[model samples]
Target chain A: MKSAAMSEAAPATTSLPYTDTKPAGHADFYFAINATFRFILRHRGEEALRSCWRDIGGSYYRPVSKQWTEQGMHGVAEYWRAFFKAEPGAEVEVVESADEVRLEVARCPAIHHLRTHGREIVPQFCQHCYFVNEAIASPAGLTARVCGGNGTCTQRFIKRTVEAEAQNLEDIATAS
Target chain B: MIGCYDFCGHYEWTFEWLRQQGGHELVRAYWDEAIHQDSQLHASQLIGEKGIEGMKEYWGPTLADEGAVYERTVTEDVFRIDMHECPSKGFLLRNGLHQYADYCDHCMGWIGPLMQKAGFVIDHEHNHCGQCWWEMRRIDDASPASAPGTLAGTSDVRLRPGWKSPATDHYERATDPDDKT
Candidate 1:
């Protein structure tokens, strides 16, 4: 229900790395993201698909990394809070602490929209979170770990100094 | 990860990425196979089954949802859209994100194939500044696109001041992105 005018009227006090005129994005774009993943997976192997995700995380999201590098975990929490606010149908809570930022996604907008429309989701869809987030965090001296997925999940952005195991692809559920 | 708030930014970046991965053929195939066949399957189904009515039904809510400023004109034989402010292109332009050459072509890249499959042809033009006009007709209609002000009257995008600034890419009954004149 958030309209472009509302976003424009709000004070420029947001943590989003990029700015858009709209308050919430057009939800239909989820279709394109899902389609893009499917296209890459079909044409290229899983590794290449992962590379695409990683490349995008490092390239397209460099501004986010820069912000996180400058502001630390507080920036991470702020970014996620602003990000989900602009994604329609997303229900998420971003909790921040001294050491890390955690995002509890109650309803993932992309997965929800794709499933609602009966679109076939790529099984490795959730893995993009690991690859892309890791790429983004690595540059900011942080790391991301995602556990559950397919609708709900816990994503944590923590300092690189914290001793945590590498992400297990199995931890992320296959989206339907 | 890749949020939809800046989908147009990364979406344009992905075009250059895909082009580097394979070539222009890959980019074209991605538009046809992924976009037209996959992401826009609903659009394809609608237009294929209902034709011009489908275009109206689809674009009505879709454009409104995207917050586009435009007018839609429908005749029995043709459907025309005069875009005064394209939400997608406007977003990219506002954000100053231009990663690919002729980002406007992505529209024709996907919509052209869709119209072709739906047995229609397009007479279109875009100024790359978020202003464009499209006229869709049955392939057999054989009539050329109407002159500016003839179809949509003064609301015609082509008649708008600065509509031809910089340059405009025109397509005559084209159903392919490469058919630009």
Candidate 2:
């Protein structure tokens, strides 16, 4: 299992749908991400916030879904590899096999950055990975499940089928 | 995961999402509450405590870290920025993502309120092509916005031949996003 520690390594050219002139993103933006989630949750309640997450996965990320549909599991692996690389302070490994892609997030960058900066992370912060990823996965004949969070987690993307177990929200941790 | 590398993409997408859920007022509230008060608290604190110097302190490293190509001109009475290529808008333009009708307005939506709290007012304009200029002065300063090249010298963004757009939004002594004309 080769895991890329993005903090120490130079950025590799990625297959990301959106490319920026900067190699990695400014970590401070995590503050905005946390704040946006808090705002939505407060103003609209949990269900509406989750719906917004789903909409992001389905609509904003439609291009990534299209690529996954065309290229199958390979596209999923490539996307995560590139995605994590562009996130500053991310420590993740994308392990790909014939059946699925698993992201072993050793240090969830958003949580780490937020904590370091003393930002009050929304409690529901970590669940976004599940909601957004699942929405992105389902349309490509795939599904995602996440477990463990608040600085470390396992996210798996696998083929969608009747036998696949549904994700348990309890598996995702709440941020402090 | 909603990674920050494409934060502008989803951030822009979120504007439309909030609008759909609760209309434009919700979007406005999101900017003022979520962005100005929450996300950019450091900016608010700095500008509030230090005024013009704080604007320089805040935007200096922030823009550099974001890989923006721009110039800044600061005086005793004003702090001005000429954004030649806005990194946020550039990312969205390069990625072909346009969810909200006017994505550029998000800046004013948050910064306007921040300036208001800091006892400063803004004179600004954006061509919506990644070119914009901002001048921040004390609220009581009666001096109007300087002519294009005066404050920033030749670095003024408005001097560029391509800086004009029929859709260009302008603000004078604005303390709210809706103050644009």
Candidate 3:
């Protein structure tokens, strides 16, 4: 596994031209490169993540999947590897956005990688995403997040407030 | 519910041993890792030919829809491996814990010593109970599919002298999903 600092040295493929179907919000995808990307959120989803990258491109065209480094990326990758045992030479599709991403999918790795490593890789992938939902079911129903370590890495942005009647009471006095 | 070639958590140790045998590249495990011992499959030779590409060939059944696939886990770091097997839905084993547990006390018992000699760490995943039975078909069976063996018989997939089954699950934790979430 590569470290989070490992940049995808392989040149990003420009082969995918922006199609008439813009790669925008919750964009219904018709294809994707099947690596670990083939299985995100696939547990119960009836959605067909067809691995159709062949017609669009080549077999070796992996995106230097971020799993080679980042933990959350690793988590996402592991999740798929366990769930989706892809047949090689098989091409598939996934739902994504204009940036070619989504909330209920592989993007979770990015969001998860950010929220957990907020002190490290956050500033990079933390770009504004309009889909993060603050409201959901009980804590159990909250967006489930887990790491390769089997620990919860879900985003829990609960708000808390502290108050004091006397400001001085809150401050520690100097002995001097 | 995780499993290894022999014992639980021995995956890393197994990998280390295979490495010592001169096949530690990730592709080594990927190649023939899925071959049952009965197959006489050569994992090392396969790696020389296909590497990761060869792994997909020996892996499991293909589901028609993407729905059958879960998000695959690329991360592999076994935090623990359980030594216990459920003899049945709730049956328990009282003193099955072996002193050296790199492998089960049954057929693959030697793996423990082999891995130890190779300087790999081993830990009991702390499973004390077990369920014993047999199966002719595992994945597609709606219930425990009967085999030729009697209740005392063990399948190749089970520890010797007992026959329940290892839950087919991933080693890394990334696979623990929230069915309700």
Candidate 4:
């Protein structure tokens, strides 16, 4: 993998919950993410692993939840826009409207890096977006739905009042 | 989605999370089985195949990618890393994220096992404040770790101020996280 020089500053408009010196993150960490998922799935049962994801979203990402609660969909849109910008090799577009924020992930940096390195992607990899994002959204009176997977997906974060159908796990494609 | 941007935050959190679920043994297992054997398999493969040269190849680009400010010294007998500013630990420190007892141990936890398999042992130390040093040599090499400035000269991390803290953990020709002195 090519090592890109760290950017001296984060984008001015981005509202990241946490801050770092480097503008973009190191892509090699994607290996740890894939490895962590496989480890949890193998050692803990699927239920426990899912619970872990929820806990991470609800707890580790509490700051994001708070932002969404305060700023609503706009905060969600800004967060993702900045988030994807900092991720190396990500091709994502965050579109915002009156009631929701849509994230169209044309290329997932994590999946791309993992595949490029020939790592075995956990089959349930894409499910994390649903479970984790839902946990982050729920406290903010919002809901998240994800469709498509493998390398690309559309994620919608909308007000719970929108009456969207519950996510069907089948909608998320199994990763390789 | 969990991102590489704040990986240290969540990674440290996961350590504490795993500890809460299954205690320290499970954390050790995760580092060895998941991190050493799975995530860092490339490091293991390289060092296993090429020894010290592999250490150079693996850490060279990897540390640069991580934005670490450090120095490396290579010799026929040993490979040394003087970590003046560890990007991973520094991230957690700067973000005020400390979920694990000693986040620094995670390195020894995984690398120790990998090196053991590669027929090497490590002499290392870390101050909770993101400064550390590592020396890896063949297990049969009984040479003690070099004093400050001996291996890498002035670039040695131990020569820097605040290198030794009250909470520094030291290892001597060891290959296990729990084997610290």
Candidate 5:
């Protein structure tokens, strides 16, 4: 009988990956939630990085700004180069093994919203969404369970290793 | 693919323990009330340039007094750590000092005090799902749709319309060989 910001807009047929209870009646809930989730999943690192860029590109940030851009993104791409190095300025390592799913997070900016008007239901949205893979490291990942208020996740990020395409941030930064 | 599976496997072992333990804690089940109440707690509701009085009423010392994991995220300015539930990309650790952007120029909003008292911050992960793990090698094994290019399939993308910033439109006029300026 609990109502959430999206519950009213979510449909009864759609089941939350998080909870057992069906929603009351919002039809768009399924679409919104799924869209937001998939969006985060697809653009996880890229989106988080872009948040800081947006603040910089806009007039919203300055020397003393307390924005995510100001507090985070201190070293920029250079931080990751040192972080991923075996011993600073070393050769790039391949993520050949699953055990080493480690990556350092630098300058993460994430903001997503879930909104609903009378009949319209909005899905959850944020900078990025972790995957079922991410859950593997945590207990929730272990059992595929949902914790917290009604199984809704809080936005967060963790770093991991992945190969770079021909063009990438670190490559661009290191070029000069 | 077991390697990828292991790489993608998610597991959390702590927040449950804390959530289960009986202690002096403030855990909200449904945050709708907070959302509704804060709407009226608008920027103009208070008097003065910065509303220091309202701010004092809003924020207090952070739960830094409590025993917990905390970090000052450089990019996000998210300085709190989750005690247990590490869900993934969406499961972020945030004092979420940035959530109160509506009123305060520097997170001087009520959310700041709220973050302070809560001690550790775990965001509601507005990101609906994880990222797209798809790679395209062939297009339908032939042509048609694949000729121009393939579309990159994304993961859950609920809160995403205004997500990307549009480029500025300050294009200069075309130059003509015969035209004299």
Candidate 6:
């Protein structure tokens, strides 16, 4: 975790868009995230949960969208690099190039922690990566596609001008 | 992805989103159903089976993991906590994220129902400045919350000069977040 002062001193200089006092976030919060998804799906429906994801990506992450818009692929790469670094137990490799950024998730910290603690994960858990990331990327003239899940996945963020197929929800595996 | 690194930021934002989707009732339901019943089931099981001991078992490692600066006091009759610096609220404050109204109430929103299910009542107060105290007693105890310094001695959060704020919300023998004064 980066300090608030550090983030303030040079917002663009830091890899993470937001900073916290701790080096890494407490993994237990993953429980709440899964539970929140479960509650919305049960009480409202699948659409409502997806809307929640979009709202978070679009509104809550507006700063990130702004950064991605201003700095392009570099901003996306920096953000993911810092993001995975602050997620405890995450084993991710962020590869950035001129046109896109790809995240190779070897072990997802949230899934690992929830599974280790015997928490029942939402089946559509991996879809959140596409919905939320797409919402964030769209505003920056980019798009996100995710494939595989449960324990590992490949996430790619590419410029909207690049010809690419839309993400198929089926391609994202159901989390056990 | 909704990363946990800034969970509180999005968590608070989600509260407002739920309120807009359904109303305050939906937000309340989310806390009881999602948080107390599902997310924190371990806490429920522990406190339900062991009472005060369960609170210690649950909060000790939990608070430490969240990087909270606080103190806990326990006795045969009650379990008390003095939160000098709440990590959750502090994060929102530090990052200037305030999407929900009275984000502090979220604690009671879930914990109150959990404690009620376990046959206990809560006496709690938060100043919205990351300073608060909690005293939990059996449903039949009826003892009011201890005065500053009585329960946690020098660690009493109420004794802090900044503990009193105009935005302070207080509760006494309550099991509902709406029961605050």
Q: On a 0 to 100 scale, what is the lDDT of residue B74 in model 4?
A: 95
Model 1 earns a TM-score of: 0.97
User: What is the lDDT, from 0 to 100, of the residue A126 in candidate 1?
Assistant: 83
lDDT of 1 by residue, A1-176 (tens): 11223344323778886677678888889999999999998998788999999999998888989999999999899889999999999999999998999999999999999999898999888888889999999999999999999989999998897567788889999999
Each candidate's DockQ score against the native complex? 0.51, 0.44, 0.01, 0.53, 0.02, 0.50
Candidate 5 error regions (>4 Å): A1-125, A131-133, A136-176, B1-23, B28-181
lDDT of 6 at A10: 20
State each candidate's chain A TM-score: 0.93, 0.92, 0.16, 0.93, 0.17, 0.91
Per-residue lDDT value at A60 in model 2: 89
Give per-residue CA lDDT, model 6, range B1-181, as digits (tens).
8889888888899899999999999999999999999999999999999999999999988887777888888899989988887889988998899999889989999999999999999999999998888999999997888988887888888888877998889899999999977
Which is the leading candidate under DockQ? 4
Off by over 4 Å in 2: A1-13
Candidate RMSDs in Å, in order, are: 2.1, 4.6, 23.4, 2.0, 27.1, 3.1
Regions more than 4 Å wrong, model 1: A1-11
For residue B104, give model 3's deviation from the true position in Å.
19
- Give a tens-digit lDDT track for model 4, residues B1-181: 8899888899999999999989999999999998999999999999999999999999999998888888889999999998887888988887888778888999999999999999999999999888899999999999999988888999998888778899999999999999989
List TM-score per model, in order: 0.97, 0.96, 0.17, 0.97, 0.17, 0.96
Better of 3 and 5 by DockQ: 5
CA deviation > 4 Å runs, candidate 4? A1-13
- Tens-digit lDDT string for candidate 6 (A1-176): 10121222223345665667777788989999999999999989999999999989999898999999999999999899889888999999999999889999999999999999999999999899999999999999999999999989999999897467888999999999
Q: For model 3, what is the alpha-carbon lDDT of residue B63?
A: 14
The better-scoring model by lDDT among 3 and 4 is 4
Candidate 4 docking class:
medium
DockQ of 4: 0.53
Per-residue alpha-carbon lDDT of model 3 for A14-73, expressed as tens digits?
221111111111100111111112221132121211111111111111211222223233
Query: Where does the lowest 10-residue lDDT sum fall in candidate 6 chain A?
Result: A1-10
lDDT, residue A63, candidate 1: 90
lDDT (Cα, 0-100) at A42 in candidate 5: 40
